[model samples]
Target: MSDLLRLLPWSGPDGRRCYVSADSGGGPVSRLADRLEELQLDTGAELLDHVEELLRAHRVSGDELRFCVHRLAEALRDALRVAESRGRRIPVPEDEMEDEMEGHPEPPGLC
Candidate 1:
């Protein structure tokens, strides 16, 4: 494993290891905020409200919440990349694409 992977908490059943990316450790809400800032999105308040709802629904612990936030952030980043590659405008709301991503998994192709 690379040095960065070595730094992650990698533990699971039967001595198997699960590596959480550095970004994933930051939780979903924070991740979303960071992505929005990067993309210069205008709907920060709406996105934050959605994240808050999710957090409340999950009632997740701080650490677990952070992981979820990170995943959401990464998902947003991936979505933005897809949009950009297609020559579409970014900062599209997560609600607009969340259903699509959930229903249609991306091929294991290179970005």
Candidate 2:
């Protein structure tokens, strides 16, 4: 969705703007969850609960929730990439990285 794209902060990498793919239908959450499940990663109901809390905290609508979910999915992908680059196991937990992956705080007045 364009709204999601607008909300995202863009950065240039190698002189090219990097952006995450959008999920107009909000499908990325389940897709990411499925991937995690396939890898025997934790995709439990508890995490879903946290996601719901985050959406509510941010006043995210169903459609907007899709964007947030997709962001998280991207974060996970990045984490895996970092691990792979270091010749370590995929999905390795890194403290600061985890905080970033958790996403930014809801904008003022959102809650």
Best by lDDT: 1
Instruction: State residue 54's C-alpha deviation in candidate 2, in Å.
Output: 3.0
- Residue pairs with backbone atoms closer than 3 Å in model 1 (clashes): 27-66, 27-69, 27-70, 28-69, 28-70
- Name the best candidate (by TM-score): 1
Give the per-residue Cα lDDT of candidate 2 at 76.
Answer: 68
What is the C-alpha local distance difference test score of each model? 0.47, 0.44
Write one digit per residue (lDDT tens) for candidate 1, span 7-104: 21212465453333333436664355345444534343456666788777876679867866776686565455434432322334679756655776
lDDT of 2 by residue, 39-92 (tens): 433443445567878867976678767866875685565455434322321243
Off by over 4 Å in 1: 1-54, 88-111
In model 2, the Cα lDDT at residue 51 comes to 82
Instruction: Identify the runs in model 2 with alpha carbons over 4 angstroms from their true place.
Output: 1-53, 56-58, 88-111
